[model samples]
Target: MTDGPQGEATESPTRWKFSPVQLDESEILRRGLDAFAELGYAATTMRELARRLGVSHNFITVRYGSKLSFWRAVVDYALAGAERERNQLLAEHRDDVERLRGVVIQLYRMSANAAEMNRLIADESTRDSSRLDYLHQRFIKPFWDSIEPALNGLMAAGHIPRVPTHILYFAIIGPALALAQNPIADRLDPVATPTAAQDRNSTADALSGLVLHGLLPPSGSETST
Candidate 1:
């Protein structure tokens, strides 16, 4: 609808009027994350994102300034909880193994919940872009490095295998990370269907046991290397 006579927006002559607007901010960010992850940065547009969220075409651009900025916001919202938990584990667990295990479990839990973030990470990791740099510096590197001390200590004691931490990182996370592929997960285990809570708890418990078994020394094989 066009404005009044001179193509100017009509305004209230007397009292001001304002109404409430209902918006789901979390849903907006989740949709934004999925869009960017599914469609690469070059292809994702603010107008399209707005349409997906049922907002005004220019709303995202006006509010977020640019697409890159919006992408950063989405990444932050998705990874913030995991980052916070990583810091908490570091602060609370003083012992080497304790800290390592705590961080591993938290990472696994967060990773399971953050499949879109993982997909985005996988996409960005293929190229040398600023988004990749931001992800590595802001979230990914710190997480992988947090367990180095424990790894070293265990390695020195002939506990875990002497694999480099990077390889070890992929080794420990790869299996759990496979949960991101819901198709394979559903098809492979069709006989046992569990509630979301039951699935999450069972996944964590099973992965933790599998990882620790590969890392920790045998019951009687704990000797300093």
Candidate 2:
């Protein structure tokens, strides 16, 4: 059976109902991400993906119909995983700031390790706004929305300076991308680059500091309601 996008079925229900075949979407995505990391999106082929999956080249065609389709499906799968992790993180934190920091750090750590798949998604995203939109809607946007209230609470408590939640999100993410892109991450000096754990703690401190002490021009200290 071929893997479709996250919401798409591995095989039609009719096919599964008649035949007792099983499919592994995560496994397929793992191999696809591996291939994309090593070969890049344009260079990676269905045959290579099949090779990684220990299946025949025809299997990929049979399952996904085309390379483009398979790649798109992989993107969905990756985003789905990110969304799952996000939900779990949010649940664990339960609308807490520290928990939100953990959530962002965990995602960054995952992306850092997912070199191939992350590369493919990044490249595709540059050319395809929809692909980026899919990622944002599934992972980034919800995460920001979920934490907005907490940020506002911090502001009211005088724990942080009042700022747009989106700005805070942008600040948090800037360092995350840095961690993912850091070359030291791939080497023995992984610690030289910020890991998820590192980002979690540092971001919390940075955000807290920013909240308590407004980082604005001396004249622009006025907080917007």
Candidate 3:
């Protein structure tokens, strides 16, 4: 008999809840790039990216519009720093040989820092799709374009062995790519891994040695004197 007016119609308690914190745009883009690098374009979706960023899928969709655009944003974000570094190196090192060496060293350091991006590029290279084309045009071409002039100047000045720019590009980047893409490359090489403090310096030294030795003008060459 105690059903008087539905228990006096008690008011529900105000449930205090914290709003989801907004993540920084740069942080979102950085995490997106890392996810794309690890998962590749096709395998990674907005949902997965949002999950990686600890946001909702709508966040990515609303911010980036579509997956293609998101992928482009990720690539652009990842390459922006590289483009700046390349330009700075080119500006700082006017001498052809010195510039080329600086570029090679910079690239080696970049490759070490961006192994996941390199892996993503390696993955993209296997397929001839627009995504790959986008990356080539947007990311890879800018880098090659910046270095081509330096490489050409080196070849013209006889500071480096006269080889095709493409060949020279590979010569400078190939070893670093191999080391970055292959986790076991350090073990495969004769040299032991360096301490954490010397990791970058040691890599720069090894890559610089390889490049300098390979590009040094052969004996009796005009530039060798």
- Which number leads on lDDT? 1
Instruction: Give the C-alpha lDDT of model 1.
Output: 0.74
lDDT (Cα, 0-100) at 117 in candidate 3: 72
lDDT rank order: 1, 3, 2
Q: How do all models score by TM-score?
A: 0.78, 0.56, 0.74
What are the Cα lDDT values of the candidates? 0.74, 0.61, 0.71
The true-versus-predicted C-alpha distance at residue 63 of model 1, in Å, is 1.7
Tell me the tens digit of each residue's lDDT in model 1 across 1-225: 337999898766322211121356677788999998788787888778877877667666666777888899899888876767788779998888888778877777766677788678777877999999999888878877888888888787667778766788777767656645666667677776632434675676678767877677567865434
Cα lDDT tens digits, model 2, 175-218, are 44443443555364654644444554454455444433443224
Q: Give the clash total for candidate 2.
A: 4
Window of ten residues with lowest summed lDDT in model 1: 13-22
Clashing pairs in model 2, backbone N/Cα/C closer than 3 A: 37-116, 160-211, 160-212, 161-211
Tell me how candidate 3 scores on lDDT: 0.71
Which is the winner by TM-score between candidate 1 and candidate 3? 1
Q: Write the per-residue lDDT of candidate 3 for residues 40-98, one digit (tens) a residue.
A: 88889878987887876676666677888888887877777777778888998777777
Which regions of candidate 1 fall more than 4 Å away from where they truly are? 1-24, 40-43, 194-198, 221-225
